[model samples]
Target: MSRPQHFGWFLARGFGPHGWGHPYLDWNYRWTEPALYQESVRTLEQAGFDLLIIEDAPSLGSPATIDLRVRQAFGGPKHDPLLLAPYLFAATQHLGIVPTVNPAAYLPYTAARQFATLQHLSGHRLGLNVVTDTGSARHFGTAPPPDHDGAYDRAEEWLAGIKALWNSWPEGALIADPARGRYADGTLLGHVQHRGDYYGFDGPLNALPFTDGEPVIVSPGGSGRGLGFAGANSGVQLALAPLDRESISAYRAKIHAAAVEAGRAPDDIKILFAIQPVIVSSAEEADRVVAASRDPDDAAIAYIAEKQSSDLETDLTALDLDAPLDLSVFGGHVSQGSIARLVGKHDVTTTPLSTLLAAHARLGRISDRTGFVGTAGEFADLIEELGDWGNDGVLIWGDLHPVTVHRILDELVPILRRRGILRSDYVTGGLRANLQAF
Candidate 1:
């Protein structure tokens, strides 16, 4: 099937009823209110957003730390991604629902069954974003956590196991024979066994996943392990850096190379990037909003310190912000390439601590690279450029409330439609079908 142009919006948890803001934390809130999220999803569906990425926090890690406290203060409650799925499905006809899953926390079989059921219910509109976390292992409630490589090792096997279970049962295996009282064909559930370095599993999953191939398996970015995993799994969409053409090209090349190494077609892997759009009626208005929402230099520094939780307050504050990050000083503790890029942008050696903080504050939506911040026409241009440069689509977030992102659906979608870059209406099926992965 031909690849369909894909675009998405992310809805996260908020710290308050109005926004994701929290007084204790330096960073502003990310998730809007429930009513806003619902409205946003519907608007995005109409605007032709191929998917809506509803972030799920299973374990309270670094980011979730902020969310957890906020929830407590707000008198406790809200729907998680899983519960939100059915609502979104009912609200929109074609938009995809991608809920992130961390393999270490969730069982492979259980996750497979959950996603499979969602796909079945949404008519295949579900997609899985597999995340093997690195930085915040302490939050997993394990005293001694596995290393990054170790986590990926287990994750790789877990993913393989899930895929095996998905394919274990063939179509027509479930006769549901009411007269005979036999629900399944006993011989059809193929057993799966694996004794790899990090994981060991046996037999078919209790419940079959696809009965067909399954939902789109989406991978975020290119780590060595992530690339290898995607290469082994065909039809996986790879999410990469948004807006930067150079990064997009490089990522696509890496994905294709990984696919070739794994004996799969290069084009089988789809590449997407994060786009934090700041849309407005005029270019000036967009710029103003972007600037207003950003953190001050000192605030940025404090936020970084809080994020790292290293507590080397004096030493961190002593460094100059204009110099490149001292790799020797920050070798092991930092998270991934994503965070690394955020630090790399500002030279922290000579600049003042406050200066450094503000510079690195608004890390670009995708990998800290500067991206779209203009009128509707300018955004359309950026999207087209991304496509031409080899990225499949963008996973978007906005600076302000629903208005900034909502405008994309209202304004930019129409422009994309006019340019033949976006679909005019629902394509007759679910997320997987719309993505042309069917």
Candidate 2:
């Protein structure tokens, strides 16, 4: 027997160029305009997706890496996803739109007000993918950014202040009795005063109270502090780990433990792993795709190098391909996990840079159970297996382009529905309700 699981799409490219550097570029959908995203999200809703998480990094790297970031449009040149959320809401009624938000960017009062407005406008279908990145501190003119744990401390304060403002208005505060010629009972609203180590705010938020609930809180962090934050505050955890039964179970246990420590039920938070599967049409085609990528040419390697360079903010294209990569070249700001991902099983001391680059460019076929390259049926089998493992759901990651959305969902959706692994209809309330339906 198979149980239904939640599904979502991750807009990995943020609000930057969609379908750029791909065959779909010829579609000319105009990334700056809303029509492209609106159409894409409509398709997602029709497929019964629970939400769409839009990724954003609000900074164009430091001066040294600006060109690398934008030269390939891998990073930066992004418009605010928060601004893009309203248009997405107008296009679809049920699919939750989660835009990335940083605590460092906005004051507590402003962020609470703005988020409250969106949650009401979307009819409680809005979500916030809260991020703790402090790299954009310079843009906000705040004091210097804090260290790892300190950043989480600031985010904790920020979230607490926002919640206090949201709850300032008591149950009887809104007394909209038209016959009595009364709009609201101002006396019932409480004055909330919050003065913390990182933020200070006094408010009974001007925004109206929610009819359903506050906006869904989504978070993506893998560190101990990050996991603790999710356990304490998040409704959805954007998880990342190897997609195996043992690994998945262990990861989930950790989250459940953290939730217990925080005095929250584990069911309060849904752990949705991020997966990008290459959905092909047939097994033969999958085999051919895998075969083609076994040995990448110079062009393929160069493309991989450019993407890695943008992510690390350290130029890799100029490095000698034949020489061993020096780990010390990476700055303290660079993520050690990212560096580990860039240099997989092979060692940096002995392996040449080209070998490492070529390894990343390689792909494996799903028929052999090696990688994610497979037909719709094969992908469905993977999803069903995840459900059996007591997984909450999986988020299919890709650009928010019409072609990309259709390419993956067209065949995969039907197979999933047939197996009773995907929902065919959504519940009435909103994102929170739909997620809790099963």
Candidate 3:
């Protein structure tokens, strides 16, 4: 028997071109318009997904890497996902919409006011996927971005400042007694004055108080400081890790311990691991997909290189495939985690560039139970196993296009629902209620 778990969709490409490189581009749906995203989100809501998290990075990167960012539309040309949330909210009744927000980008007062308005407008279904990426700080003309721990420190201060504004209005601040001509109790509102190392704000936010709850806080960070931030602030922790029992258990234990240390219950945070499973029709097709990727052709290698280039912000297409990669080619601004992922268990001094790139293109079979390529039944089995290990849920990652959304959820949702691993109906309330329903 399997227990019910939450499910969500991650718009991995942010608010950029949805079906740009895929065959689905021929579907003729304009990615710039709102109709495409609205249709796709409705599909997710019908499939019983709890939320949709949009990923965003506001920078096109340094001048040297502009070509790498937009050459194949891998990373650049993204519109503000925050501006797109209202359209998503209007299209669905239950699915929560979480757009990526950086503390460095928006000031606490401005963010609080904008986010508060949306929370009430969405019937309390709004969520914030807070990120601490400081790479874009130059775009804002702020001081130089801080180090890893310092970035989190700024984020902690940023969140505290936002919350202070949110709580400025006390429970009895609004009376709304029309018969007595009394609208509110002026004395009940808090006068929040905050001056921190990174930010300072005075607030008694000019927004109505939330009756259901504030917007749900979502975060994605795997570092110790990141996990601590999640435990202290996030309602949902967007997780990434191997799917094995021990790895899953240890990851959750760290989050639980962090929550306990922060004076919060372990259940306060939901850890949903990110997975982009390749769904196929038959076991034979799954085998073919896996086999075809085992030895990537030149075209496949070029495709992988383009994506890695965008992420690393360093062009890798010109590098010699047969030669070992020079780690020095990566700039100081490049993410260490991205480098680790690219060089997975391979000695950078000995492994050829072709071998490193090929590792990423290889796909394994979920039927034989190695990786995420498989039929719907095999995919559900993996989900059920995660639930059995006390996992909260999984976030399906991909482009936010109707074709891509249907491709993954069409068969998988029914299987999950039948096994009681996915919710058939959401409880009344907002995103927080949905997460708590299980």
Candidate RMSDs in Å, in order, are 5.6, 1.3, 1.1
lDDT of 3: 0.92
Candidate 2, position 263, lDDT: 100
Arranged by TM-score, best first: 3, 2, 1
lDDT tens digits by residue: candidate 3, 168-273:
9998889899998999998888899998999988989999899888899999988899999999999999988878899899999999999999999999999999
Off by over 4 Å in 1: 1-4, 12-18, 22-35, 62-80, 135-143, 176-183, 193-202, 208-212, 234-244, 286-333, 346-352, 361-371, 399-401
lDDT of each: 0.61, 0.91, 0.92
TM-score of each: 0.78, 0.97, 0.98
**TM-score of model 1 (CA atoms):** 0.78
How well is each residue in 159-241 modelled by candidate 1, as lDDT tens digits? Answer: 88877877777677778889999889969778777677655667676664453347777766467777777776635454645
Ranking by lDDT: 3, 2, 1
Q: Give lDDT tens digits, candidate 2, residues 1-438.
A: 599999999999999999889999999899999999999999999999999999999988778888999998998689999999999999998999999999988899999999999999998999999988766777878587788788889999999899889998889889899998998999988799888998888999999998888899999988899999999999899998878888899999989888889999999899999988899999999989999999899999999999999988899999999999999888766766679889988989999999999998998766665788999999888888899999999999999989989999999999899888989998888889998887
Candidate 3 differs from the real structure by a C-alpha RMSD in angstroms, to one decimal, of: 1.1
Worst 10 residues of 2 by lDDT: 329-338
Error of 1 at 438 (Å): 11
